[model samples]
Target: MTTFLLFSFLQLAQPSAIQFTNQDLQLESNSGYIQLDWTAVEGSQYILQRSMQPDFTNSHTIYQGPDHASFVSGLDNGTYYYRVGDDEGHWSDTLTLKVEHQSMPLALTLFGLGFVVFAFTVFVVIKGVYTTSQS
Candidate 1:
């Protein structure tokens, strides 16, 4: 079938190497969310794998795509291993991460809100100046 031939061709065309940059990992809201990000690969798809054990015998796929990153949500406080690979079976270096629950300190939250207000005020002032100059 035509679909079969196309699939074969794509398999052959898959690259052997996929490099990732700008790798970032974060846990939001006390291990409630696991957000993973990486630099996009130039010409390859990504297969994201995860395992609870370091040995990875119980690994499971989190995603597969060319997007180069994924977020694994609803993970409890624990350690996890991750890796990204190309369709050709070439894999980048492995990464290990731990998610920990964190409570938002009231002081920090207030400070962040203050910063947002200050930024909005500055933006309004700049916009007013620009409009006046244009007129």
Candidate 2:
């Protein structure tokens, strides 16, 4: 009887593991930003951490709240690692986010070059027409 009681107490004292409703987390990328979404336990405070290293040795907490989704922006093009943990210290699986932001300066330069070419073509065609009419 004592052995049974001890086993029951031990089982009750064991910490329960935190689980996410979706095992496979989804990552969405937008221009200049990335969004992380997951189905988590309601009313639970979670700590969101990010690191440039996959091992997460230098990870830092970006957010600590009850929200199950987070948005991160203004990050340079690179791979980032993220993980979430509850207040009880149970951590979720690590998620990898790869960012590839388009170069704004390059885009602007291409647009400007295209506009100049178009304007030059239109001017040449108009000049040729005017000269032929004069002739």
Q: What digit string (tens of lDDT, one per residue) describes model 1 on residues 1-135?
A: 999999999987875455445344422245556556665657667788888886778899889888866877877778878777777777766677777766569658988999999999999999999999999
Q: How high is each candidate's TM-score?
A: 0.53, 0.60
Assess the local accuracy of residue 110 in candidate 1 as a C-alpha lDDT between 0 and 100: 85
Please name the candidate that would achieve the greatest TM-score relative to the true structure.
2
Q: In candidate 1, residue 81 scores what lDDT? A: 81
Where does candidate 1 stray beyond 4 Å?
Answer: 1-29, 103-135
In lDDT terms, how accurate is model 2? Answer: 0.79
How does each model score on lDDT? 0.73, 0.79
Q: Give the TM-score (vs. native) of candidate 1.
A: 0.53
